[model samples]
Target: MLESLLDGIFNGISIGSVLLLAALGLAIVFGLMGVINMAHGELMMLGAYTTFVVQNGFKALGAPWSDFYIFFALIAAFIVTALVGLLLERGVVRYLYGRPLETLLATWGVSLILQQFIRSVSWQFAAGVGVFCLLFFGALWLISRRPDFEQIRGKAIAIMLPLSGAISLVVSNLLGQTYKFAVTLPWFGTQGVDVTAPKWLRGGLPLGGYQLPYTRVFIIALTILCLFAVFWFLNRTVWGLRIRAVTQNRSMSACLGIPTQKVDALTFAIGSGLAGVAGCAVSLLGSVSSNTGQSYIVDTFMVVVIGGVGKLVGSIVAAATIGIISYVVGSNALAPLVEFSPFLQGLLEFFATASMAKVFVFALIVIFLQFRPAGLFPQKGRTVDA
Candidate 1:
């Protein structure tokens, strides 16, 4: 029993790391700009596609650096997604500042457009080269209609919050109760599992009679490294200081000759970049797809909300707490009891699936907000005034 509990903890940490990465961008964007970015997950999807493209490109070049391709994909994904974020800020987001609900609808439309575009491209590619070319041109034409920078940066943060939250819920529900894996190996052929991965990346680390996968360890290390870097940036550098200033008081920072517009752009870029890195980490854990970002979106928002918007410590603590709790709840030891509880039993019947657990968790968070509107660790002093 104890052994199973420990295993669940390990699984939770791994899952939580991915959630932390996905939420970091959403948190910063929300805390600073106040936008509910509905398109954030699509941005992540774009990053994943970027990785897929890079992988294919490498294969075409006859390069077999699968291990190193992950790093390259991360970099490429960041650059592509950051540029898209910049474009989004300039084009659509700018006009909708202060009108959060409108921004939500608009970004939601954008997300659909992105998904459809991907679907079209995927299907068209399968059809032939000519159709792919037509679709590519059409996508370019559509993207050319974006707004200006001042407007985008102004509204970007404000529009990301609810957009991110709602989409997360939808995603959680869609992935309910099933774990699917598609494993491929150089040595062995493809196989299906509840969860899939490369052969070398599978298996576990020996500990007594138990074992833990190397992938889990990598996730923990990567998440820790990312969190450390984020903290270091927030605390140590001139740029970080400037970002803090803008986050706290945009007008005052503008008065101090801080190049507030540039700062906003850079901050958006960094946040989006972190999200791209998160997408890469996600790809390692599960099959890369358009909906992948949806899985972690709810938990990510929870981390930011519970941690206090824009608070790093809050995100970290909230992420770890949620991870551990969800893990314990999902484990065999507690599953039966949770399933038997009258209230939870109703919920189980309502959701009746493991995947919907994320939605339930998020629903609980919304309820929590009703009581503690300011969050678990609201920013203090002048730090939160912006």
Candidate 2:
């Protein structure tokens, strides 16, 4: 009845929040850079693991202080993964620009390396080195502020490209020998370290004859916050202006002294950092593991593709559409409505299964793409050479 209907809608929105988070980064990177980062999910995995590390570290401090760790974990995840992304841009991705196929293969390799390293290495060691990378990059970022480095700034990426790769390998090996996939905390759970929502979010609120979980509300709120933040940063800031100019026309932007290379790197870093935050939020609902991020990769890409690649509004619409449709169909909440018709019942039964729902969703995306290959909100005007 009304309860089932309300529950279905809430579930759809909750799932949509996650989609918004995971797809936001993909949309930005793929839209602006024209580079499909297959390793984007790995960057998310890095963030989740970073959260786990922070959680465990906080656990040792006894009571009170440990309770507030999730807040810190989110920030840490963003900072750490952002640095990794900058190195990735400077080292491997920079050289492969304009070569989509090669970028795909190389990034896929990086993903594999990241996954294996997470499963086998010491996270603390890897994290320590990541901090060093952050410091090193911070120094470089400062140098970019000086007038003397303005001309040489573009060349810095080229000069540091090889070194970036070396640094990645070193960080991988520096990861400790043992791997702890999960954490154990008293408040979250007795057996494992779970991201327990705050007390206010531990209960449900009744609405329209159904009780909606506070966690879902929190997630939706977080997604909206992120969206607003991204919108403001892109529309209001100088860096955002540079990014938009480059996105419109890279060659012209460079001709106008826009420092296209820095924009590319900084933009990638921001996108990757957003993915890291997505991972941190995801950890609240599920177990954080090496393969956790891989699960969201395809769905995220679909959101970017179905929405126009470079269109923020398109990403939002596509993500909400896909999320609602997928959840409603998969959850079988519509089955009761069709119970009167035997044939329709059978069809609903078939599509009610999660796997079948995914097949249906993918099929729908393919059909949609066939009609609107440029997506729901394609960019207009002069096109850049991809």
Which candidate tops lDDT? 2
- Screening candidate 2 with a backbone cut-off below 3 angstroms (N, C-alpha, C), the clashing residue pairs are 121-176, 122-175, 122-176, 183-193, 184-193
Query: Model 1: per-residue lDDT, tens digit, 341-377?
Result: 8786665555544555556566777888898877888
Count the clashes in each prediction.
26, 5
TM-score of each: 0.73, 0.81
Name the top TM-score candidate: 2
Q: In model 1, what is the error at residue 76, expressed in angstroms?
A: 1.4
Per-residue lDDT of 291 in model 2? 80
For model 1, give the 10-residue run with minimal summed lDDT.
184-193
Encode model 2's per-residue lDDT on 52-77: one tens digit a residue: 87888888976886777778888998
lDDT of 2: 0.80
Model 2, which residues run further than 4 Å from truth?
1-3, 123-200
